[model samples]
Target: MTLSKAFYLLSPRNFALKSKIPLRSFARGYANSEVLRKTPLYDFHVENGAKMVPFAGYSMPLTYGNVGQVASHHHVRTKAGLFDVSHMVQSNFRGKTATEFLEWLTPSSLSSLKPYSSTLSVLLNEDGGIIDDTIITKHAVDAFYVVTNAGCRDGDLAWIKQKLHEWNSGQGKEGPVEHEVLEDWGLVALQGPEAASYLQSLTSFDLRQLTFGTSAFVPIEGGFNVHIARGGYTGEDGFEISIKPLQTVEVTELLTKVPVQLTGLGARDSLRLEAGMCLYGNDLDETTTPVEAGLSWVIGKERKELGGFIGAETVLKQLKEGPKRRRVGLVVEGAPARQGAKIVEPTTKEELGVITSGIPSPTTGKNIAMGYIKNGHHKKGTQVAVEVRKQLRPATLTPLPFVKANYYRG
Candidate 1:
């Protein structure tokens, strides 16, 4: 996947261009002022007593009053929890050169990925900054499944479409690829230590055989089959089920009919923070890069060598010679340092970084934060200072996920 080859592959993908546009946003809601986009499960969330909030131009559930955030987090840690992730954007790409097409947008070596296997990848800007972080799954050499953040929907779709028109009309090209947007779809995540047991009860398909980071279609009651993906934002054994919008409510009721408790965004945010995962707008935007974010691991080795994908020149240079600043974990003292909390050197009070995400860990009973600091101060155990309420608070750069992951490899 070299630069020229990558540009060659990025030329044919579909985008939903005719969707309605927002003249105003719900961030400041008022009658006729603005309205947010709603997921397919919007009414379902209301029926389940969800505390909805405006997020990423969509009306989404923040938390449920019946289940406190801490309890919900713990429940998901010990047992399965259900979430309506219908806000995420899902799309499909299929053509004789689909694999080659996707390699141009992301740095992962998609051509070599096994069927039904997925890899976390980044969509880099030309300057080596992250445009968006993405997950790409290969169903066949001629096809792929791509999931990107909703926050970047407009920009991502526009970029993909612009690239498509160019790719299709380019000189000596293979022509357009078949692409589909699974719009108005439903996505549900069932995660925890007991997730496998809970999901296994629904089908004769022995889920124990499904390894982590994989996906397959699985049958459930009501004759509904779903693309069950064996991965989640929480660092626990889980499955992300992709379903049709029409069947979301019924499917959710069926899944939660078991021991699984209904969870919301509050618990989801805390769980992800505890896992040291990045939240799109908070932790990353158009300015972050895989290398600077300690995600160089996501870039394929061949991609590094071949200089494929956008921003390859800068990413490769940074990869060859490490980035000046790097994302890392910190175990801070005193109160929790939430987003934008400044990180500084303890002795000199010189600013180092700012907390991108943080939480008072219910499982660990510690204040944990994740952020980027100057490369030299990123080593484990390095003491740092965080500015909380204008006062310097002592903190240390500890290893990530203050609590260890409990993923079931099998």
Candidate 2:
């Protein structure tokens, strides 16, 4: 499913009106109403007049009050916005072999990652297809914290457990690894330009020391100590705070006092797209490899040469020769082209590829999209046509991240 389609499927009844997009059937569908789960701050969302919707099997807030998606998107880009991402799965892996086990499952160089530093990594199947994208934080050589997508919860957990069992049963070098799921934990993102200042007011910790991709446990105003990671999906200088279940509501309330609006799925989608981040089910799938998805940087240089991880052969081969298709960003003129839209040669109308995600970016005020096209035609400035609403709209290939990322490197 395309990211837009997935959002539409899980969105509330009034979502079409709010987003100003016509509702249409998608080829891939998600089973809704099977059993919807609630996050720790469900009641908090309701009390604040949030429009709740079913997303990734969780009842999540789509927007707050009467704030339109474009307004929320702009708020996140200019000021600050708070997001309830508690539905995401958080887990801890520990044991003597934890590093080795994770390295085997992914292509990231976990051993070299400094303590409290995080790297975006992907879980690969045997054929190098992406299972799920994850953020792994190294607290110690034997201990690591992982965060994964909520939509892939059951499958991801099952796969990890099965692999853990298999690795534990064998006798190679390091000891058995233990996996612990942090169920009911709260993960909130304080994102945007003013995110750091708002968070600094509530804590004494030196925000300057916590650069992007690094995390630290710090005490907040209410004496609550939480893990604060200095990076977010928005490609802005922000922080993702992980809190205990019992303190979730209080911490969120404290953070949303002023300047930080309660943003939801609607804005989150646009922000991520502008940032050039991939949405799992939409931009990535079991049949897509990381290299093809434009995630080659996640693979460690040593790991690429040594070829220890699963699907390394295919990834290494692609690294050497190049992938048949490459993920690229696009600037479509006239109209916004959404997921499943066809990319074709401008004149001959020959098929090239399909759009996985697209939106009229509030930050850029232009139609932007991300998808894969034939390798040679994926270069910047290459003109192509996108089939939107049965009309071929002119488009040009551009670099990923239509907006300049403002990550605080310091």
Candidate 3:
């Protein structure tokens, strides 16, 4: 099977509810074991007794010894947590046509983006289905920095390279866009309510100046120069620091000192889910589109009016009309409705959709979930039922972000 097919098969869509397997295990199982990779902090994770597991083709930490997943989850919500996200693919796109090139690839309008501002965007296929979600940072009019999920590294790299070649040689007046993959970098996310204060102690550059969705190269303690982005997947006030591979361990060590818990993938999954973020393999795939995935905001207003990006036809149609189904939040009444659990009408028993991601939230102590539901039933407060195991649990459509996000916009 192709890698995409293999991933789709391993995804939660095919999971059996009775197995009651830990979701983390199911997520890890998606990684190909025959050719596993390691992040720069692999040794650091080992020394910390992190329970390493396969993820996105890398052997990554699941949780540290004696620190349970729920504990780590709560720590990040209350105080702070540090996560190693170095496996993600980071790249630089430069040249006079960089802005135009990126605009053609994704729906975001890069021209109006001020320097250091970043926007979440998606790479779409010809059918408008999402290839992968990414963060694009406009460093300058001629330069852009991008970070994509580790699980999509190979596919994203290939797609960008092919498109770059075409855009470079195609009918355009600007200089060719240059692509530079930054494979020698290590990324660490410092998250939670106390993240800014903790990070502020290590840098003379005012952490306050770097508001949410903005990035800047700053020197930290130990003279380590790194690109610090003031935002994270966890819907909390946080910083994602990109450092040189050789300095990864030192940077992590400095950040994980007391009050800042060392977190792993297990907690990270729950955190992002609770924060209403999508996990590529489970919550998003090649068949999903930004509009259906509730990510239409990524498309610029101008782009929507004068469509130019790939799959603009389908996307704009969905934007003008509405998607048949939409990604929405849910609150299950009983037994957490995990991925693959069917959503149906209570009395008619008509199937509406299936759950994509769900859990007994560690932060809220409630069964919360996210799934795509038929458009008419996606409105908040809509009543539905989730078939968990052999029984149906009552559920209510809730607005996304089970918890309010606390981003540092200032």
Candidate 4:
């Protein structure tokens, strides 16, 4: 079976209600025993009844105990959920020319970014294809903290290292930059409606001051000083906390108390889908551009005119002429359209594009999907058809974030 088909069958909707198939069985099927890595919280997860699974070269938790993924997903939407995102790669870049160095790699306007503020940016290739989607936090004019996808670790680091050498050698006029990889760091995401209040009870630093897309060093009640960023993959209000390797277990133990349940990849996937967030391997890839992926806002306005970042030529051209195809949200009528499912014109059945990510939304009670389609067919409310299980299902193009975002903008 295709990967998308397997994923659709193993999705949360199938596990708790439709099938008696155990989630662990599906997890084991994806495991590669030869090279699986473990995060710092691996033991902590097992102690908390987590069902572990191999993902992105790491053995990560799929779900906790007997709680269904739907329940975990809803709990995060209503209350709060703590996720072990330590598998993601975190790095620190510092030097006199750090901002200039980063601007040359990404399309974001890092020079204009306020200290401690963050932006969702993309690392682009020479042809303007997305290398990876990342969250970049500016610590100072000369320092930056970057988080990238776990799956792209090797490629991203290699690319950055090569560029660093070239920039330090001659390209950068200000000074040479240094790159430090935070290996095995413990990164956890505390997400949902009550995230701030629950986190406030543990930290003396006022979370109110740490608004969305911002970060700060906060002192936890237990004497742990860590970095806390006020944003997450879920559309709800949340914080992504980075902890010291030695303090990871203790900090995680403290956070996973009453009202802060442990969440796993299953719930994380569904939650992100409901939020219209893209998954690296499934929804985004190196073959796709940021503009075509509906991430045009990440390209800085000033950078657009000056055109210095990687793939600037292709990106700027697309920005003006528009892409041939565009990523769009869809509300599938019948079955959920998994990745690789064909998108076609409703009437003539002309091939348009293919589905990249989809799920039965627990919140909306609708089968929602994201995919690329011909540009003219991407407008909201445009009628379309998705091929699912060898049948065409009626669908409509819709706006993203099927559920409204609850960001703490203040």
Candidate 5:
């Protein structure tokens, strides 16, 4: 029987991963009855009684034990919640022209980035559509740390490897750079208003210096040095810690012991939705431009004029004039508008757009959604209509980030 999201609060204790799929084949779907993918913390998740479910090819915890999605959602907002995000792909690249290489892949200006600082960027296709969205962290002129969603693994890796090969066989250009995938690593996100205070007791490194969008290697209580990044998918102040495989289970146990709760995908979905973050398949793909997704900020000013990267000409032109359709926030009235929901002009019933990512936000108790609207109606507070089931319902062109962000600046 399909259970309502509310019914499984604090679920059953018997949890196990019947199968474990590898990280390389992330695009393939998973089924409980068939093959299932596993993260580095798979064994630990089973031991902790996490309810394993098939998600984006991995057998991940959707909810833990008997704790429901709502309770976990509340815990992360008010206190602290720990998430097993090890399925995400983490890689480090180093060499001269690193910034140039990355700039060719994404529209962001990596050269201007401060050391240890990160920026959200997108890999665009030759047609100006996004191949994948990613986070690029600058350590120095020649070093970078990048993180991409697990769902986009195959496409992203293939693209990068192909580019690397092409760059290596260049016309007497500098040798191609090298990259290492931290494939065996595990990641945990400690998020909430109380996150820093909770994590502060375990590390000697000054958490004060690590602001949002920044990262540093920190020495922890058990003497293990971890890469602590001060940012998260949730809108709250939080950190994403990257740990070695052998230390993962121990670290997860230590962090979730007292005050910290183990949250699952349900809470994560709602939180990211509230934060105005896009899920790859739903909001972005090879057909969508960064400009329409309210991500023009990522396009570097210098890159716009030069236009040498893939889709650079198309993306730059769109930046100068504007995209035909624009992604924007929405407040749906009546039922929650889901992906593929048709958006229409309220009075004339003229088709305008479609919903992309949406959820009934557990934080604010509102039905918030995001979608792409036709060029002219992208402004905030513009009225529109969405077809739910069969009838049209009113929707407001709301400002993004249904909730406000509480990033740690100091």
Candidate 6:
């Protein structure tokens, strides 16, 4: 659904993919119950004993009946877990200049991307600030599939549509880019160590060949065809299956039949946090640039030199001169530092930045956080203090991805 439709249908609890923003913010923005919306799997969630919560305008599952958040988190790490991510905005861009259009939007090198390959990218504004973080998958020269955060639905769509119009109307444009929003599509993320083995039994498309960052259209039992991508937000080996709205429920039921645990947003948050992934509204905002977020690797080396994309001047400048502040991973000594927690120097308590995301890592048994800190203080082993609960907690800057990622590259 378009963000406006979703927001108006949404309720006070606020169901969304990116909710690192304080709950008070949501209360102020969308407190009315009439605006709450639901995904196609709303009935399925209710039937499965999901604890309904308002998020990003949808009534989403926070956790199933008796299953605790920690259990679900561990289950996904050791076995398999099913996550309903249908609230995310999915779209397709097609046209002769589609590649160029995408290149112009982000700093990534889409021209060199192989078919069926995907890469994490960011949409930037004219000032080189990030509009939203996105996953762009190249299906063909003219066909591209993109998945953006649910919370960014409104802004992302508007920016993309406006850019498409401008690109099409430009005098020297080779061809216009066509934008298609796939509203209410079903996106199921099957994650964990056993994901491949479970999926292999239902599909004959050689799951082994579908390595990380790749995707293919495969036929499953009951003659159902779906688009499956080999990557997930969690640090586990997994697949994200994209199905038509009509077949989503059936496909989800079939996939969750045996070993897959029904996971909810509670676990999803901790999982992505441990995986070192950034949530749009929290770790990323329009004022933040990819370089400052430690996402310089997403920029292509050639693209860096050519400087073609929007906000290239600022991004390139940051790459060359270095960002003033850098996002860093930290291990807190006591009490979990949450969003908005101030990051300060140890002795002087000089504020460097603030924590964008933080949680007690289910895997590491330690309080972990990701935040922006002054460049020199971002190195590992550096000492810092996080203001948690009005007290300064000892923190040490550390490497990101608290848990090692396990993507099936082979």
Model 1 lDDT tens row, 145-257: 88988778778888888766666666217746767889999998999988888888888787876788888988987899889889899888899999986898888888886
Provide the lDDT at 57 for model 3.
76
lDDT for each candidate structure? 0.79, 0.89, 0.87, 0.88, 0.82, 0.87
Candidate 2 has a TM-score of: 0.95
TM-score top scorer: 2
What is the alpha-carbon lDDT of model 2 when measured against the actual structure?
A: 0.89
RMSD of 2: 3.9
**lDDT (C-alpha) at residue 233 in model 3:** 84
Kindly list the per-residue Cα lDDT of model 2 for residues 1-410, writing each as its tens digit.
Answer: 89988776546645744674322211122365377789999999999988877677777887788898889999989999999999899999999999999999899999899999999999999899999999999999999999999888999999998888888988425699999999999999999999999999999999999999999999999989999999998988899999997999999999997899999888888899999999888889998999899999999989989989889999999999999998999999999988889999999999999998888888888999998898889989999999999999999999988999999988
What TM value does model 5 have?
Answer: 0.91
Could you tell me every candidate's TM-score relative to the true structure? 0.90, 0.95, 0.93, 0.93, 0.91, 0.93
Q: Which stretches in model 1 have alpha-carbon errors above 4 Å?
A: 1-33
Candidate 4 stretches with Cα past 4 Å from truth are 1-33
lDDT (10s digit) by residue, model 6, range 168-284: 999218878899999878999999999999999998889998999999999998889999999999989999999997998999999997789999887898899899998777788
How much does each candidate deviate from the true structure in C-alpha RMSD?
10.3, 3.9, 4.8, 4.2, 4.9, 4.6
Once fitted onto the true fold, the runs of candidate 2 whose alpha carbons sit more than 4 angstroms away are 1-13, 20-30, 171-173
Off-target runs (Cα >4 Å) in candidate 3 are 1-33
Better of 3 and 5 by TM-score: 3
Tens-place lDDT per residue, model 4, 133-198, is 999999999999999988888889999998898899888867999999999789999999998999
Q: What is the lDDT of residue 325 in candidate 6?
A: 94
By summed lDDT, the worst window of 10 consecutive residues in model 1 runs over 14-23
